[model samples]
Target: MTALPDLVLFAKYPVPGYAKTRLVPALGAAGAADLHRRLAERTVGILLQAGAPVEVRFAGAEEAAFRQWLGDGVRLIAQVEGGLTERLIDAARDHPHIFFGADTPDLDVGVVASARAELQNHDIVIGPAEDGGYYLIGMRQARPELLTDMPWSTDAVLRETLRRCDALGLGVALLPTLADCDRPEDLARWPQLEAPGRCA
Candidate 1:
């Protein structure tokens, strides 16, 4: 039998003060925590429904809170202690892993399936966000340099990652762009996106 493709997601415990810090100003700490929980659940549900071998790499100061939110039958691991780039590069070392931020509730399972399919033919696949950052990144193998010195959490991230791919002569595939629910304006769309336990 063929080995199942791995789809790893990066997540945090959705704590009040430490999660989604960028939107905390608009959402307030508690509200931001709620949003993070809902988004993480939706992302996990979608990936699980897609029938992929999914792993959620949870990294944050609060491990117990994260453990409680995780349901049964999913692989959970603590992210290696480091900067964002270091953790991601470490995760990518294992499989043709795909990493996502916890904020993109609009990401569909088909996008992930498409990414895996493309990985069969390409070295790297990225789902670009409308906000100038990428929503998804998948690679056939870990290329530590791709994550080492790039400007993260900025508009230049996707551009710089692509530049690195070119420098290494890696084949690239771009997926359709999507919006991430990271700001006050994005809250308008939350009503339509399903959040089973929330007022969606």
Candidate 2:
């Protein structure tokens, strides 16, 4: 069987007032944290079922909690102290990797597989998110400069990343855009959350 590509799922411990803070006003701190936990669990489940080489790089949580949450067969790594860009750059070094956020509930394993395949022909692959950021980013090698001093969490993220790719002479493959639940309005995208007691 062909070796699976490296897949890194970025996450944070579902601590109230820390995780998913953007939605705290609408969902309350505890509610938002619950949502974060469910989303991370769901995304991890999808990747695990895909049977790819998967690892979870997490912040604010103990390794034991993650092991128990994700179950066996998945590697867990603690995120280093730094901004998001630094952490991501560190994870991408020395190998081709698909790094994804836990917020994208609509993202599936097939998209991840496609990214791995795309890396064979391109130096980078990015799945754009509806929020103007990206849901996933994959690269054949670490290019920290591409992500340095970026306008993170802004509408410029995707555009800036593409510009950086051009400047670095890296060929990029674009995947279908998806939605990430961040604000209260964005919750409408996930109909399952509308049901009573779901993601409560």
| Model 2 lDDT-worst window of ten | 191-200
TM-scores of the candidates are 0.89, 0.93
Q: State the lDDT of candidate 2 residue by residue for 70-186, as single tens digits.
A: 788778999989998888877876677788889988878788778888887898999999878899888887878777899999999999999989988999999999998989899
Q: State the C-alpha lDDT per candidate.
A: 0.79, 0.85
Q: Look at candidate 1 and give me any clashing residue pairs.
A: none
* Candidate 1 residue lDDT tens string, 1-200: 33446778888777799887767777788778777887888788878886878888987745566657877656888899889888887787655777777788768888888987888788899999877889988887787888898887788988998888998999999999998887777777776433436733
Q: Backbone clashes per model, in order?
A: 0, 0
Task: Give the runs in model 2 whose Cα sits over 4 Å from its true position.
Answer: 1-3, 194-200
Scored by lDDT, the top model is 2
